[model samples]
Target: MVYQLIKLLPIKHLPTLLGIAAVLTSALVAPSAQAQTKTHEGWYQVEMIVVARKDDTGQEHWPSNIKLRYPGDWVELKDPNATEVPNTTNNSASATATAPVVDLTKEAFYLLPASERQLNTQAQKLQRNPRFEVLFHNAWRQVITNKKESKAILINGGQTFGQHQALEGSIRLSVATYLELQTNLWLAQFDVNVGQEITQTWPEIPLRPNYTAATINNLSLDSEVEAELEQALANENPQWSNGNFDANAAAPEANNYVTRQIILLQQERDMRTSEVHYIDHPALNVIIQVTPYPSVATTPLPTAQ
Candidate 1:
């Protein structure tokens, strides 16, 4: 009956009718796609803990006693900074003793869209944005635990110790895609502090005195790892570096370092809510988790009396 009705319709009207039908179909499909995307995008609460551990003849210990924790949440890649560290002063009985200070390397977490091309572009823009510093400062905060034992300390946002600086490194956090694009994930970059160097005072004695020391070193990314990250970014968006090659010529080496780290995190595993993921580096161990905030239904406002 429908076919007969269509046949009876004017020929010119058929084209218009088909176009309307196509539009209707698209309108129906578009909302479902958008809704799915929205479900994936939202504020996620995160908890990250970093600790420095050492091993001595099968015994483990925390030498630097670094048990730093950061709790935060964000809705978008460009969301406000989620961490902050309060300024603190050490009080000592001896007037001659130097007052200790703690400093945190401020950092912001960005969720890279699934598109590799967009990741590169966003990465460049994020680095250039002055607000990123503020965002980072807000996301990461330093809390003073033991004022007496604590000395001059620097914490890296990258999760690894800085070169020649004790207990100073960086941590890079982002949401990305993983392995064969099979999963949407959260990733982080940092050097994992494992064990320290030990020196024995009396080697010939049965019971010898030994000294355990925390080894400070910069996190090094091998060429193979760097190439893998570069390839992954290129695959996500084939035209990532197409138009403005020379414009980025003077880009700092740190930018490339961060880009590589972002890619490395994505390659590790899919991110799940409330599940902790540990990435081990030679100088530190990083523990991170992502949890979605519970949605609350809004109630209707009461009418004025």
Candidate 2:
């Protein structure tokens, strides 16, 4: 009946009716297509790799200045293997199923799995390179907030040195008009010449402000602190040696000069989401990428009555 009515209409009117049909078709399809595209605003998956170059000749010599400290507001990445806590609700569950309770106590921030890491190929290349030493590699997911609300994440790896680390510090991420990454990392070198003899390598590192912990200005790496720490180690473990440390093993001499020789890698970089960024230094290098995390509907645990 509608086809018979259209056949009776004038040819000029048919063009206008056909145009209206096309407009209606486009209106129906446009919204669905737009909804399918993911929007990135809040959370992101961040991956980072820190590497030290063995070929850098300048690192072999003691630096003219030294100080090392961590940022005051730094946070350790949540270990997923340690515990299972719910961070999302079961909104996607069927209407027939009981509504799962959302835990208010569970933190919104946590580390994702190693399988979620997208930079395994880059890490493998660095590990395989003879000139490079892979110090720290981590991938975690967290909310990216503005500078005022953003907190720094601790970056630590490599060998241990009496409550300290061979590589220890923090990297911070914040978004203003753009996403930015700030690195305040240090690589601690043991004295190959410590307890041997006061040679030219034993250049005294003067008192310097540990400005690496940008949030804390009062931080200082004093010579007195080093001397006292050395004396304590001397009293506790005479067997303590440089480079290689065995807590049980006895040392041949009193290694009193064991402290941090700070080789810092500090930089501020503005980044775009999903693009890999490289921050390089003479002593160390960092590779990082931040990608938007898709909003996922996770099944929540059933609430107890």
TM-score of each: 0.23, 0.58
Give the per-residue lDDT of model 2 (tens digit) for 64-170: 35555555566676565555544344655453343334322233345555677877766776677677778887787667777766777777787533344567788
Candidate 1 local lDDT, 16-121, one digit each (tens): 3333223223221211112112124333444444333222112222132222222121112222233233334444544343332221222223322233121233
The lDDT of each candidate is: 0.29, 0.57
**Model 2 stretches astray by more than 4 angstroms:** 1-41, 57-67, 84-109, 192-194, 197-257, 296-305
